[model samples]
Target: MRRYAEVKTANMLMAVELSRRSKGQLRSYSLHPGMVATNTVDKEALWPAFRQLDIVTSDMKPKENGFERWKTIPQGATTTVVAAFDPRLDDKAGTYLVDGNIAMKEQVASHAVDPVCCLLLE
Candidate 1:
């Protein structure tokens, strides 16, 4: 989660810089699709953690899990698709998105608003 946050911070910084450099001709976004079910469990090294989480949270799974029990591939693609093609978001530049909506500013890091700090990360 820390690494994710760091990457998101860097991404937000890049988005801001790119947006400025492009003179409003570019739109960049950082986003997460929640816990989507993918072959990562079998192909990557996160299976042990995922398996343990599943065992612990199985009874707490909600009906909105995206499929019979877990998040589907399509569900994971929704936010990316929206961020890329949503006309309603024409003015939303240098933003973080989650579940197809703009993420709260507080959810991003302070560095995201500081070009100097953002550059330091690079």
Candidate 2:
């Protein structure tokens, strides 16, 4: 999932750049909808692919705690809906959201919002 993280970082960087360059003409955001139970992934193929990478999933089972549970489709769509229409975000362009809310500073990586890192990506 390293590649996935890389792509997510890039996506947020683009949002920042676009929002800055366009000023008030544009608003952009990046968000992580919580892990949702989707049928899009082919479950049978995922295990073998993980095996090929020597990934040990024995200890990677789903968390049964109050957190880390998968959401249904509707539940997972909450963030997207909020990002698109929430008046509370009127002044919060280029933000990264998690679980339908603005992510706390501690939740984001420093480099993910750094202009130097954005330039390095070019």
Candidate 3:
């Protein structure tokens, strides 16, 4: 999680710098698909524990389950599309987005910002 966050931060910073240097209207954003039908849930070690926990919780609906939901892809895509194309977002650089909403600012640890991980984002 920390590594992923760092890579994302670096990518956003890079986008901000690139837009500034080019004098173009641009914004940087990030998103997480809450739950979509993907093999990652079945295959990723990181997700199974959470998936099992969700199953155990009666209040956790199938729509909320990462492995079961199909509608989330389109819903999740909206956030990115909005961030990229919405005129209201113009000049809003260095913003983190989640689930189509502006994300709260948080400090990320330096160790997570591995150059190798940052390069992967490129």
Which pairs of residues collide in model 2?
none
* Candidate order (TM-score): 2, 1, 3
What overall lDDT goes with each candidate model? 0.67, 0.76, 0.54
RMSD of each: 4.5, 4.1, 6.1
Compose the digit string of candidate 3's lDDT tens values, residues 13-120: 565555554566555554544555445444446554545546323433344444444445678577788787877667665455656665544533333233344454
> What is the full ranking by lDDT, best candidate first?
2, 1, 3
Candidate 3 ranges beyond 4 A from true positions: 25-28, 48-71, 106-122
Alpha-carbon RMSD, candidate 1? 4.5
Q: Write the per-residue lDDT of candidate 1 for residues 18-91, one digit (tens) a residue.
A: 76667778887767776766655554465445545552234333334332345688988999999899987778
User: TM-score per candidate, in order?
Assistant: 0.70, 0.79, 0.56
How would you encode candidate 2's per-residue C-alpha lDDT over 1-122 as one tens digit per residue?
A: 58778998999898777777788578788998986756533366565444444432444333334245667899999999999999999888889999899999998998887766667545
Error of 3 at 58 (Å): 13
Worst 10 residues of 2 by lDDT: 55-64
Better of 1 and 3 by lDDT: 1
What shift in Å separates residue 41 of candidate 1 from its native position after superposition? Answer: 1.5
